[model samples]
Target chain A: AQSVSQHNHHVILSEAASLELGCNYSYGGTVNLFWYVQYPGQHLQLLLKYFSGDPLVKGIKGFEAEFIKSKFSFNLRKPSVQWSDTAEYFCAVNARAGNMLTFGGGTRLMVKP
Target chain B: DVKVTQSSRYLVKRTGEKVFLECVQDMDHENMFWYRQDPGLGLRLIYFSYDVKMKEKGDIPEGYSVSREKKERFSLILESASTNQTSMYLCASRIRDRSYGYTFGSGTRLTVV
Candidate 1:
């Protein structure tokens, strides 16, 4: 079975600090990657996705992810963090023609203002 | 914008009681899914539907069933709600191409007592 791994369980950052969350998946095939964010008491929203072409994908709210096929990684990054960016981030992947996705353990980010 | 709506924000059920978690999507998507989010386990898929009246078991489908009588609605049922089933349930919808990210609902937090 395919699985995703997120290296960080919880991360605390001061405002304006750089942010990066590591994600690795155990799948060896054409894959589609995604990043989702869940704000406090809010629903999960798509941050970004990678289907094909570009390896680096930019998303809303200054978020971005890079799909590195060789390393099986799709790491989420932000140049600077803000309090509003505090949320739980999840990394998900599915086979190119697969119907379901496998999600990582998730990284809980706390941005301190 | 796509919208996936779960029927409840929170629910409390007794053990051994039947529980139903409802979800509806306004985008007329071809795929709908149910997932349970835990602190460390992340989002574990419970079930999924590709079309009306069609359902497939996911990674964790034991003790759970699903219904999809219409294209816009999907329901997750717990035959006998157990304390271990307490978690946040999320509903999501996606197009058939599998190129885009999923649109998720606000989630229903179910607690069995």
Candidate 2:
């Protein structure tokens, strides 16, 4: 079964701290990767996505993700996190095998002021 | 701008009641998906429709059914609500040919007691 795994369940960091949320998927074929974010009371919004081109994709809010085929990982990263970045982050993977996404358990990131 | 909207923001239902969650997208997307988000489960695919009147069961479709009567509308139906089924239900839409990534709704928080 294709599954997405997130290493950190919860992460707390001070403002200006570098942030990295690990995401790994277990699929042998070509896959599409995505990073989504949800604020305290808002909808889940797309942060970044990787389909074919560019292994590294930049997204809104200064977020970026790296898609590594050998590692089977598409990790979300930001040079610095702010208080508004405090939210839940989800990593998802999809393949032509099925259009459904396999999402990780999510990482709760809390950035302190 | 693309917008996905859920009919309800919060809902309370009895354990044996039938529940309907409605989702609509203004983007005229071809693929619409229903997902449930829980604490330990980031997002479990419940059902998806690739086109009007064409539906497919997703990973966790055992307790749910779906409807796609029109191009921009998809509905998730819980045959019989259970306590264990209480979770945040999200609806998403995407254009199949252009991009596989999704634009998600605000989500409906359902509570079954």
Best model number under DockQ: 1
Best candidate, TM-score-wise?
1
DockQ of each: 0.87, 0.71
Instruction: Give a tens-digit lDDT track for model 1, residues B39-113.
Output: 988999999999999999999999999999999999999999999999999999999888878899999999999
- Candidate 2 segments exceeding 4 Å error: none
Task: List clashing residue pairs in candidate 1.
Answer: none
Question: After superposition, which runs of candidate 1 have C-alpha atoms over 4 Å from their true positions?
Answer: none
Expressed as tens digits, the lDDT of each residue in B15-78 for candidate 2 is 9999999999998899999999999779999998999999988888988998899999999999
Estimate, for each residue in A1-113, the C-alpha lDDT of model 2 and write its tens digit.
Answer: 89999999999999999999999999998888999999999988889999889999999999999999999999999999999999999999888667777899999999999
lDDT of 1: 0.95
Docking class of 2: medium
lDDT of 1 at B68: 99
The per-residue C-alpha lDDT of model 1 at residue B87 equals: 96
lDDT of each: 0.95, 0.92
